[model samples]
Target: MSRVILFNKPYDVLSQFTDRNSPSPRATLSDYVQVPHVYPAGRLDRDSEGLLLLTDDGRLQARIADPKFKAPKTYLVQVEGIPDDNALAALRGGVSLKDGPTRPAEVERIDDPALWPRDPPIRVRLSIPDSWLRLTIREGRNRQVRRMTAAVGHPTLRLIRWRIADWTLADIAPGRWRDA
Candidate 1:
């Protein structure tokens, strides 16, 4: 049987297990995880944090990360400004980024009570209020959420991926991992 592991990656950590010459210091999976032969299914940027799936089966990893599969990924986005209905609708309908037009997503404004605080809090403009948004997309483009939010006039201050398909970050704290 193939093994799937869910890791709640902490902020500023590289997605890869090994990095000999990273520009900045980071905590990698090799430091905390002891599972051998398992590799990450998809990559989360160094700045972004949350659920990262690792698997020993290469085929299973491809299936989960491939855009053709259309596996939904849900993100809890903290934006610099509250998104209006039109903006939210635009995200649901689809938004054009530098790469191309993205697939329509499932988006909603949410009052999330279980959000964990970041080690270094997001910068606040004070005059501009921040709001939380729940965004789900089938495509896993690079920095897609940040670009999409920026296109819609509400730049993402912080982004935490909460779920990927049937898997989630439920009860997982930063820098933790568990077998799925």
Candidate 2:
């Protein structure tokens, strides 16, 4: 049987096992996961947080990471400004990106989620209002969620991947991992 690991990837931690570019040491998967022969199924940017799946089976990893598989990835996004109906509709309909038009997304305004605080908090602007959004998309484009929100005139301030298909971040804390 294949070993599946669910990790709560913390902010500023690289998705890879090693950080070769930086002369100074940077946080990476090796710092958290000690399980041998396992590799991340997909990547989460260093600035992003929450659920990341790892597996020893190449086929299983492909199933989760490949965009053609259309695995739904959900995010709890904090944007710089309050989004209105038009903006929400644009997201639901699929916003045009530089690469191409994205697939339609399931999006809704939501209250801030109950989550652990980051070591360094996201910047706040007193004058500009912020709002939370629950967004679900099928495609795993690079930085797609962040870019989508920006295209809709609301740049994402903080992003957390809450779910991927049936798996979720429930019971997982930042920098922690568990067999799933």
- State the lDDT at 58 in candidate 2: 99
lDDT of 1 by residue, 1-180 (tens): 999999998888888898889686667888767899999999998889899999999999999999999999999999888899999999999999888899999999988547778888789797999989999999999999999999999999899999999999998889889999
Question: Backbone clashes in each candidate structure, one number apiece?
Answer: 0, 0
Return the top candidate by TM-score. 2
Q: For candidate 2, lDDT tens digit of each residue in 1-180?
A: 999999999999999998889999999999999989999999999999999999999999999999999999999999999999999999999999999999999999999888899879999999999999999999988999999999999999999999999999999989999999
- Candidate 2 wrongly placed segments (more than 4 Å): none
CA lDDT, candidate 1, residue 109:
94
Please report, in order, the local distance difference test score of every candidate based on alpha carbons.
Answer: 0.91, 0.96
Error of 1 at 163 (Å): 0.6
